[model samples]
Target: MKKHLTFLILLILTAATGYGQSATSDADSKIVTFRFQPGKDMFVLKGNETELTRLYSLVDEYHGRITAGELPIRVDGYCASRATEKANLHTAYLRANRVKSELITQKGLKEGDFVTANYATAYNGDKDVVVVTLRIPVKKETAVVKEEPKTETRTETKPEPQPTVKEQPAAPVTEPVTETVPETPAPVRPYHFAVRTNVLYDAMLLPTLGVEWRINTDLGVKLDGSLAWWGGEHGKTMKVWLLNPEVRWYLLHDKRFYAGVSGSYGEYNIYKYMVGNILSKDTGYQGSLWSAGLTVGYQLYLSRSFSVDFNLGLGYVRSEYDSFGMTNGVRVYKDRDKTKNFWGPTQVGINLIWTIGGHK
Candidate 1:
């Protein structure tokens, strides 16, 4: 009985050793990770494009190995805990799938070659991230070694006593752990072209329209036109059309303050004018005028695509006109080809601006 028990014990020990030696080796993996802002599926271009491009380059480098099942790729998506579970899941899904699609479509990799997961915890427990990992697995062949059987003796063994470790008191923290935040790139804005009309002109039954071409981020060119045409009725008649063009230099990043120079030209006709005088003759003036000025403006944004612009100009004006006076309900010229030059406030506008096109 004792001999049989010894043989069983040795057989069990040998089997256990062989089983432990039968192994699959896994190599360390390389990873590329990019993070998103809260409630955002896409990472900011300025921050994550480098890592994403690198990941694509790596995919290209490992294309053959990956297709042959030698190097496997895995993509995992995670979201910040700021939204409901369903929303988060959807965002994570988009993030993962978009990246995979880029690899498949742009890099010419097969979709089936990747193992993709959505809404997973990222490395270091980051809440919002997409991680791509590449791993190489090594398979080892089994080798059998034969040895002569040796005699063995069983001895009673006792476990070594684990040394008692004294718990160290944690040091008091002096400063709060502050997370470093990446600088946000400006979102899409009005790239070019803005249309506008003046509220005061509309109120006065005058038609005013303005167009702006944003030359660049800090500069713009604007053209404005207005008309106040009224039919001749009794002693009152007025007709006018004005064209103004300006170039602006925006002083604020939000396009709030702008200072620039502008030029204006107009033709005007008015019949009969009096300062509440019964004896004063009703006189009329018809002329063409031109003005140039320095303009300063303030813009208040109502939405991403709308703003209110208030601008004022101070400048010089020159005009040529023919003066007419009413005589027995007939027109009589008092002065002809008269020229006048003046300097004062030339333009004022309270404009409603609609920025055209999509955000940048």
Candidate 2:
């Protein structure tokens, strides 16, 4: 009876030990995790539901391999969106199968591999779905080698003396060569700016007006105009005016001062009042005249599109018509002639400009 009792106790103890070992081993195992989302149709590793299923199978297979000890069990898993189609039953089964296959083909899993799967519901607007999670096992092993102790031995032997000779001068040493590096050149910047002007004049003795425009930084357009009037005693009156459309080109564009040429055509008009000489006190004369001219100007910029312009240039002004008459009803006749030469300085003025277009 005593022997039987002892034997029974030993068997129980052995079983308990085995159980503890198995439990502890599984508990200490390591695992790898995989995540996936849904894509259009194909199994996409990045954003695809189909790919998620495939990942599940791979994990399952890995778990099997670890359990069977065919490969060191490395923990692995897959996380899928809960919103996937067939959220519950379909997703669960699909994940299990996929995980199993993955372990076998990709990770070389075998039977008895351990795998744990979790399923959850997800709502993706259009549908309610299931997400699957998997965990796989992994194991690590290390080996160390011990080296044998070495013994020390001592032996005495006569020293051999080398023959000595007179010292000779060592050969001259050569200096190391060095390469020279070349310097890089600086980049060149381009000059950019433009100016233009247009003008119109009347054939009758009237003021001339001109419009000026500047294209800044070689990238914009500006417009402005001017007029001038002239008068003298004795009915001798003259009026010159300019109409100009101008573009400015800044040679040295410093934002403030711009040097450019202005071109314009203008009309000049004159009225003359004549007084009779001492001998012919009975009569006086009056007449009308017309002509045209061109000019150029330099501009100093004040703001982004505003400038003060100083203009001085020459242009051809032709007289179109002329008339002469006396206040006493007496008339003097002169052909309606044109003057070919009419040139002079243009007036100084400030220009307010606006730029349009070319804002990137």
Candidate number with greatest lDDT = 1
Model 1, residue 157: C-alpha shift (Å): 29
- lDDT against true structure, model 2: 0.40
Per-model TM-score on C-alpha atoms: 0.47, 0.28
Model 1 per-residue lDDT at 44? 59
Which candidate leads the pack in TM-score? 1
TM-score of 2: 0.28
- For residues 1-360, write the lDDT of model 1, one tens digit per residue: 999999999999999888765542445467898777877775455688789788867776667777666677898888755557777778888778767755653454566778888874444778878888987554454464544345354444656544444444455445675864423232223447899998876766568999999876678899999888775446566677889999999885445689999999999777642211222447778889999999999987555478799999999999999888877767789899999999998888899999885342
Error of 2 at 229 (Å): 11
Q: After superposition, how far is residue 323 of candidate 1 from its true place, in Å?
A: 1.4
What value does the lDDT take at residue 37 in candidate 1?
80
lDDT of 2 by residue, 142-240 (tens): 343434444344444747544444444455555686854322222111112223232222223232333333333432233344354655555444455
All candidates: CA RMSD (Å):
16.9, 27.3
Residue-pair clashes per candidate, as listed?
2, 72
